[model samples]
Target: MIKPGSRWKSRVCTAEAVLIRPPKSEGLPQCGGVDMAPVGEEAAPADMQPGLDQGCVVGKRYRSEATGIELLCTKAGQGSLGFAGAALDPVEAKKLPSSD
Candidate 1:
């Protein structure tokens, strides 16, 4: 019987036994065999082109035009609060300058 820590040794022995045996010739359906195109002969363009503006920015602030608040993306923090839960009256928002 194999010990708990000797499990790896048993697995290696089993693998060695399988490797020493001659491979059986059972005809299997082989899909397109090794007739691949030469490297760079018919290679498709990169899935994504580099240097193209893919909506990724290193440092920038994304703000909402409808709100007067601006978000500083350079700092580690949440964006300016939107019109969520505020005790300010509706007349106060109207009194403020238009964000647009």
Candidate 2:
């Protein structure tokens, strides 16, 4: 099981992220449509799909609504973060209310 604080690296790109919240379902997160590998493990060489190279921004948080998975990007790369077959959306910053 992927628990909070676990680190992962994209197999097909330079993207790296930390798991802030684990998914409700059991599975690994995907990047560029490929499963991510644990930080210290050897990842097999794989090619990213053509349209999946939208790029993951550094220092951004992405979340999956379907599985309740959340990730914080630690390194930027050519692959976008995703869960299952859907792309992970960037977590929106909460707006501060104005003081009266």
Poorly placed runs, candidate 2 (over 4 Å): 94-100
Model 1 bad stretches (over 4 Å): 1-58, 75-100
- Write the residue-wise lDDT of candidate 1 on 39-76 in tens digits: 22442222222221122111333233333222222222
Q: Roughly what TM-score does model 2 have, to 2 decimal places?
A: 0.88
Q: Judge candidate 1 against the unseen true structure and give its global Cα lDDT, from 0 to 1.
A: 0.19
Top lDDT prediction, candidate number: 2
Please report, in order, the local distance difference test score of every candidate based on alpha carbons. Answer: 0.19, 0.89
Error (Å) of candidate 1 at residue 11 is: 49
Q: Candidate 1 — worst ten consecutive residues by lDDT sum?
A: 9-18
Give per-residue lDDT, candidate 2, residue 80: 83
Tens digit of per-residue lDDT, candidate 2, span 33-92:
899999999999678876777888988999988799999999998888888866799998
lDDT of 1 at 69: 23
